[model samples]
Target: MIARWTSTILAAACLLAAPVLAADLRPGTAGEGNFRVNVAASGGPSELPDRIGPVSRIKDIATLLTARDNQLIGYGLVIGLQGSGDGLRNSPFTEQSIRAMLQNLGIAMEGGQARAKNVAAVIVTANLPPFVQSGARIDVSVSSLGDASSLQGGTLVMTPLRAPDGEIYAVAQGPVFVSGFSVQGQAETLTKGVPTSGRIPSGAIVERQVDARFNDDTVLTMQLRNPDFSTTIRVTDTINAYTQSRFGKRTAAEQDSRTILINRPTEVSAARFVAELENLLVETDTPARVVVDERTGTIVIGQDVKISQVAVSHGQLTVRITEQPQIVQPAPFSDGVTAEEPSTTIDAQQAGGQVAMLEGPDLQTLVSGLNRIGVKPDGIIAILQGIKSAGALQAELVLQ
Candidate 1:
């Protein structure tokens, strides 16, 4: 699975490289015959955040930036286990929990001594999102709530998952689907991944919906994840321009870096009005940023990233050590016994490379110069840091 995921990511990277290169090469800022003018713009308050729009008709930017899911969790039990459940003797909670569940069903166990080998205590979790109506199904994740060895081929009982408000929002129940398997013998046991946790697709039904209202009064606010003044101004102006042209009146205002307020029309419903506002086109001006993922050796640079004249020199130092053993014998049976002798040797060397010079009048030229010098992600990070130190790079460098 790890290999498959890595391969998929690499394939996506290859496919995205061309478009990303093209976007990086394009010019920023609004002007006739420029890339900025060719890009779509949205109808919202001008002076809002630049991250707000692509100004396209497909509504792709809004969808990409919004989240629509909530986490739901509950404690429950898995019954009908085939000797793979938690040992009730060691896990007393499993026995006590089962007794409580049975008592709820009108089955009385007098002394809390219910020996059940076919049941295992489990925790159930699911995602309950906004707009989810009653009876809508969602996937549920089941994990052993006790000391169970495995949950393979077990059935989870009905469990009510609740939100932070202490209200039951979903009910999960179904056959647990374990992704991996396990085998046990008298002398040996082998397991893969996690045997105590599993998932059930479409195993939970929503019982309630979360309230997420975007319009309740005359003002509607649009928020940006990353707050920037330039981006906010562009967003505000684009919205004002688009709305004034389309509706023959100004209806939006840029409140701050993060929020934009739009006037709600009396003739249109709040939902419909917000929907139309979301669909309006606008061009966005992204801030200059360079993000580097050190662990994965990945570097991402924004289109606005710029660098000045700089020189970079990188060299790797490598050390090598060798050990050789020698056996010593008694010479001519003299009062000596066989022994062993050890020797060690060490050597150091530096990698062969020439100091590279980077000259940049723009972002594209900077990237081209860096790439031409065969600088990998790690090398690029060091070079960028050096440039920033020298007051040459005009962007924020974020390391992750």
Candidate 2:
């Protein structure tokens, strides 16, 4: 019973930790603990510009259009598990894969099933980098594809990773290194992070080169990480100015808000020209944005986010209901039996709202104004959403 309970707990924890969401948890229970809303605030002495300010290198904000990593995925087998592998009765595919592998290895069984408790089926994933040589190795990630309890001490078999085009680009085979761990005992089990997935650093060797001729290309395209007209214009102008000064020719042209075309100069190779252009510093512009993650109570305020002159009132109304049951007995010699009397009490408490003017010329000013209201993160999220609905928030309000 204890083992079953521990297994149940570990299974649930693994499922919950699969997709990670950073959250700040408080020490409290659902009904008996007190919960408060908290909003973080920061201040600066001077207000920053609304649109344009900090200078960034070209490479930091943009990348070559053709230079990118290709995703590779493959079905693989992970062996050397300590009784944590998938059961053939539960996952039939794992059994099939094992059978196929053993048949290929010239080890065929006359029986119906060759049961194994130290093997698991897994999916291997890796990225084939552009301009990578054939012998260069890249990191590979392994995820359990079957009902494996943990992939803690497993070694991945030789798996051929392929691109979406069905062409093999790399081969992965190594011992899996799991960052998280699971501990089990007779009565209890504890799991930290996830043990069903692991990473093997420099495990996959590139089998083929990506189809990219970056150094020999004639027309080079630069793609912006974030699309902005002002930023595009600034980038194009900077590149053109730098080229006109150094090479005595205008080689850079804006193709779109997100794309910039540069004509590879005849005197310089594409690699040298790109190397020179990416280092040039230029200012970048981003749209005013306010990012709020409702699940985690995380609020990220952009530098350009602003709020118009508006009055905000912050308060909360809490209603509590409690029930009490009392057993009543009859007096001596009376013909009354025991009875239960139910008593319930309902109470409502409302906090007075404090109204204050909120106007932000900069992020610091806005944060300071919000801090004055003493609204917590949850309350501040509501206030921000309300402000956006009222069209008072100048930045784009994004809720996650």
Candidate 3:
């Protein structure tokens, strides 16, 4: 058919094009092609376009140096565990907390021992975000500190959350909501997720305000989450270009690969300048990198990765050995006894093996070379490592 003849001609052209492409690859020069490295899954490669990636807003890539979160922690008690709570005798702290709470409420606990099984000691934690004012409700996490089985259906008593300076900044008290459960029988026990950990939404209300004023400073520093020389240069250029257009002068200075200092205009407040600065768009750059996790057989390739022309031959050889036991009977009249015999067999096979010429100037050709070999993920990995060893891979190979 015409279609078959066309396919044959195309294959022949591809085979004949290798030497011409390889000749163009001079000494110590990368091949010519545009590529972006992103494979969605094993054996099912996602298509990479010829162009670079999209630009992103500055806010998505960088953060202000002064804006941060503070941690708050406190010790507390949980009530109503339905007999799955800690035993007061084993956890003396739980008994002590109960007695102190009773004393605070003007109810005296006599000298007798409290044998309550429904109370457990716990640690409560929450994050105080930057600029969070008083009366703002934040979420809190509760974790058991005693030998309690579960925290399901328990109510946390009023606990004061303190900062590192030992000052109470918030008060947390709420009904715990657990995502898992546990059940025990006479013979066996089964548990889903850890029932001792739970979280409360809007469980803590701030009482003290952190003295933070964002607009007070005339200048601010912006820090990048991932420090890179190329990305830092690009960000600085973008900011300067924007400032020149608006004020006829540049106000941003690049301190290093990670930090940048910007002077807010005297007419504009710090908040307004930061709002405009963070919305500027910049094209990011990344080094060519190939990361492989051998345990999970995962490979992540960067956009700028390239390969050189190389010849590769890969195949899978499988050998199987099986054993069988046989019984032997004695002859009709002789004084011989029955005996057992051992039998063994082996099978060896090689399938889907091929010798292919890989011409790499771009990710498409590289993947096309792999497809010609009919290889799987493991074979792909081995071939990549082999190419790296031969100096045919243009990117850095990292094994993790």
TM-score of each: 0.73, 0.85, 0.73
Off by over 4 Å in 1: 1-70, 79-91, 106-120, 144-152, 178-198, 210-215, 245-248, 362-364
Would you list the C-alpha lDDT of every candidate in the order shown?
Answer: 0.67, 0.77, 0.75
Total backbone clashes of candidate 1, pairs 3 or more residues apart or in separate chains: 21
lDDT of 3 by residue, 1-400 (tens): 3233222111111011112332221121111122212111111211332336669899999988756776778788899889978888788888887877776666778986788888888888888887888999999999998899999999988777767655567878899999999999999999999899999999999887777656665567788887866677677767877877887766666667787666666688777888999999877767788888888888787767788878888878999999998999999999999999999999999875667888767667766777788887778889899999999899999999
- Candidate 2 per-residue lDDT over residues 181-297, each given as its tens digit: 888999999999889999999999887676555655666778899998778878877887788889886666675689876777669977888899999998888899999999999
Q: Which candidate comes out best when scored by lDDT? A: 2
TM-score of model 3 (CA atoms): 0.73
lDDT of model 2 at residue 22? Answer: 18
Which portions of model 3 show Cα errors greater than 4 Å?
Answer: 1-52, 87-92, 186-190, 311-360, 364-383
TM-score of 2: 0.85
- CA shift at 247, candidate 3, in angstroms? 2.1
Report lDDT (Cα) of residue 173, candidate 3.
87
